[model samples]
Target chain A: MIGGKGISIWFFIGSLLLLYGIIITIANVVEMVSPSVDKQPVLHELNFGVWWGILLLIIGSVYFFSFRPWKKK
Target chain B: MLGNLKPLLTPLMASSSSLLSLGWVDSLIIIIYFAFVLGIGYYLLRFTKTGEDFFMAGRDMTMWIAGLSFVAANLGSLELMGWAASAYQYGILATHWYWIGAIPAMLFLGIIMMPFYYISKTHSVPGYLKLRFGEGASMLSATSFGFMTVFMSGINMYSMAIVMKVVLGWDIHFSIWVSSITVLVYVVLGGLLSAIFNEVLQFMLIWLGALMIPIIGLIETGGWSGMVARIQQNFPGGDYTHLWRTMGSFQDNPMGIHWTGIVFGLGAIISFAYWTTDFLVVQRVLTAKDLRSAKMAPIIGAGFKMMVPFIVILPGLLGLAVVMPKLVPENMVSAANPHSYNEVLPLMLARYAGPGLLGLGVTALIAGFMSGMAGNVSAFATVWTYDIYRPIHVKLTKKEESDSYYVKIGRWCTVLGVLVSIGTAYMVQQFASIMDYVQALFSFFLAPLFGTVILGMLWKRATKAGGFWGLFAGMFSSVGMWAWVKLDPSALKIIALSEYAKDMAENMYRGLWCFLIVVIVTVVVSLFTEPKPEKELVGLVRGCTELPSEGHLPIWRRPIFWASIVLTVFIVLNILFW
Candidate 1:
């Protein structure tokens, strides 16, 4: 652990990404329900936000748990 | 290669009206990132008691941490944005900077030079010079390095503000001050430890946040083959996709330079000088916990560096194939003519990213700029304390100060450096050309300093007098050569050895000449002066120093084994593209 409070850099990164993924997925879901009037990308129908968010969540969960400070003991 | 070349700087001048508008979600992501950086700094502060702890991350970084930080230190917003623009302007030829211009030198530093640096236990590059060459050489190096590093940090600050203003329509003052204060608080709290940790975080963020552009871009353009076809169709007969096919003659390529300049000037001299000698990157590797970790760090870095072009270079190429109305140079950009080469990254971000992803992309850019500024400022603090102030303090008082005293000085130096950087940011805002001139000036030092450093490390016969005089002569001639071209623009053709050689070619050839001058002068001076005894050269010069054997490890565990793999990949990639 590089941090004095027992938080590893990996854990920190994981938590941040996890939070971001959740926020993005939730936000995009809201947008899908009530579509915004702004111009979207070429493949806006693909729902890139959901898939990319899920990928981030998967990656972040692995990092967070793998190097969690609680796991150290 | 080693220094900030024209390709890297030209994009900064290209400005347009505010391009991408950020949502509240985007602002939240950026704020969270800032909060985390400061929180980490505060958390690390309890352990940052000693000078070593503050300045060297307590000398306990793993290969991953050091390696990521090493690569991230150079992955500044300027590079990411600039090279993207260059990739649009000059084609795949800009990839030379990340590949041949970097990998060989990174491997050289890890396998050969790290032993001397680690064994000698010098805190900074100038400290190594002081040990081998004497006070005169060290003072010159330290003063120049200290000034240039902090100044570059300021330029980074100013550049980030400009990017924010142009892309997001944020006030320049707000961008500069907020970012500067954030960097100042974190770095002043935990020093290099803070910087290193944030850099590792920045590396991952950059990949995750920016990777969407290339992925979505490829999907938009069909694929690599389809993208290439479109580029060919866009600019008929223009060699924009091939790396080496168009490098045979200056007229054949968009970059307007021969392969000789790329190989000899950039690959041999500039890459070696910057990778091996520049303290900004070297300080990251210097934080490794053990000799094995130290030796393996750059190898790990090289592996990641090879993939950077996917995110950085590909986007620009995709812009060439896809960006409508076509982008123009900075000089050509105006209110009526809005599209500039520098806007390619932001334009692409706007193209592919939605609300949350947009915030993520902007956070990545901010993280890059902050980390780069922190890297320079932290390195400046360490050099200022250990190389410049501490030596003079000891010499003047004729007594060594306490460790805590130096650590205190390091903290204060961090604050001082940031204030200086803020001033420099304002100065740059007033006159943009000053940044260009200063960056070019600093570039002159690296090649010649590399010449002196390599000689001192390998040749026991290199006298102290030879090191100082050689560095002075090399720097003088480098400046002289620059002035020669400035006075008469036609001089570039002669210096770069071709009528069609562009500004980039001139930078490469000038570095090559300065390197040659240092080697010649050092050799001649050493022949006439008294050499340091071989006994005194132990742990400093290669021949006299005994390297720790990695024979106990299995073949696969050796650093050289990994380095060999990286090198093989490098060569294969070159030939693949060739």
Candidate 2:
């Protein structure tokens, strides 16, 4: 009973969610694998900064583009 | 006798200057904000002419207002205060709530679930269930949802009141009265329109306040790197190094991410159920002009959800590093108690943020609290008027009289809902973790409803008997799990229990076991029961399609579906290992 347009939209959204989930999951894996010293991990901020920037970019683009509501008419 | 007397005398002995001398600036800001909210509510009263107008804003809400209110309602003062408190106490694992749970659930709810819901053309989530499943399922869902709405609203009020009391050293009753009166007046006067307009203003303030802290804090700390270094210097460990690392045992390490099972398993399930099935959120989407706008609401909200860790969680982590070190050991003891997590952000704002920014921060907290209250009040009014009252008052069938009566009743319901929530807030001091308490309370109702709605939509075999039984099973199992956890602490050890699991069990209500048990029982029981009439299933599915000729999945979207599956698998593996 799902429509072609509805399916297409769901597919696009599902992909984006999955991609974002993977990126976050990978970031967690890198955090787990990275070596730790007695008290601190070297280059923690630099590492976090890189991933944080990437996430912000992706999320920001999505926010800007979402304003165009897809009308059924 | 002396030990007992100290508890009674503590309030009288405490300094009153901090409460009374909240300077002209803070007093002025609060007064202006209060007046503006009341003014808007009174102005919007003109629009509440009919039931639709009062309950759903005449179903003419645009994407921007609906989207903004949806996010604002979900991000209450408790969220910011709770996040800061958790980050202050537990390491960064709290951020997973945003990254792993809320974002995905929001998107799925918007894109997948909302279209189906909008097509159903029902006013509330439970109303949709009544159409899809049967009356019994709808009533059960409504009762459960009602309990959750009132209890969580109470928690939200309590958290906001406590934050204000902590910041200004005001009396707890004073904080409660101010929040309750302001929220009750607007919701009573304007219904949903007033709620929405005020929510728009509240949303802006919350964003302004939440963002202001990190900006001002970063400047004071010399920038992001300096702030990072400051935190590192204070709370030394690998736990603080990355956002993903756990803090070992939960008991010894108060900040440890011990509820991984709950987070990934039950947390994911119930969050999806909530965003997809709960009426407070679904009501906003249902009010959308079209299916596309309805879908856009949550997707837009998800984008904002991604920013929460930065605005709410990170600042809290930084606040603890910056402010807690300066406090006396006795003050630290009172601040770090598990029950007092809601006080962390407000304490940080009062201690560190400069004067001009402090007004804005406090305004944001109030706005967040009010928006959540407004959403619940509006939704409660809608359900009571449309589902409960109108059905019972069948003698008045004339269109004009019916519409007039419904609107009047909706307003009354709004007032009653607000009053009850305020009363409920008085009891919030009893709960340990506000977040877990709200979530567990919600799961009791949400899981069963989710089972019924999803099955009713996808499977024609789901009958009223099965739907009702599944609902009972789901609610019972979930509540049983929570009650068992409360009564028998040792029982949790059977589930490959981590040491942190034991700690979280003592403090927080675990609902994952209940959610899974409900879903399973709902499905299994539905299979054994008779199929619903084909006409019922067909009618529910009709709204989900575009046109008679166009198919469900166009050929063009096939590759995207495959790619998504691969990506989901990849994420699953990463989370499992990481």
Q: Which stretches of candidate 2 lie over 4 Å from their true place?
A: A1-73, B1-21, B247-263, B324-342, B392-401, B427-440, B502-510, B542-578
Q: Considering only the true interface residues, what is the Cα RMSD of candidate 1 after superposition?
A: 1.8
TM-score to native of every candidate shown: 0.96, 0.76
Pairs with backbone N, CA or C atoms under 3 Å apart (clashes), candidate 2: B90-B255
Candidate 2 residue lDDT tens string, B1-578: 43564544343231453422233333434555677788767766766677666777666666656677677777788777777777766656676666556666777776667766777778888788788766677777776676668667877777676666655665677677777788888888878767776776776667655675565567667786787688788766534434444433454444533555545553466567777787887787676676656766776666666677778877766675576433222244444442244556665565443322445567677778888888887888887776665654654653434678777777788777877777777656754466566756675677567667777666666677777887788778766666675687666664325434644442233445555565677677777777666655654643334522224657443323433443364356336424
Total clashing pairs for each candidate: 0, 1
lDDT by residue for model 1 over A51-70, one digit each (tens)?
77888888889988988888
Poorest lDDT segment (10 consecutive residues) of candidate 1 chain B: B5-14
Chain A TM value for model 2: 0.37
B419-480 per-residue lDDT for model 1 (tens digits): 99999999998899989898998898999999999999998999999999999998999989
Native contacts present in candidate 1, fraction: 0.44
Q: Label model 1 with its docking quality class.
A: medium
- Distance from true location, Cα of B333 in model 2, Å: 2.2
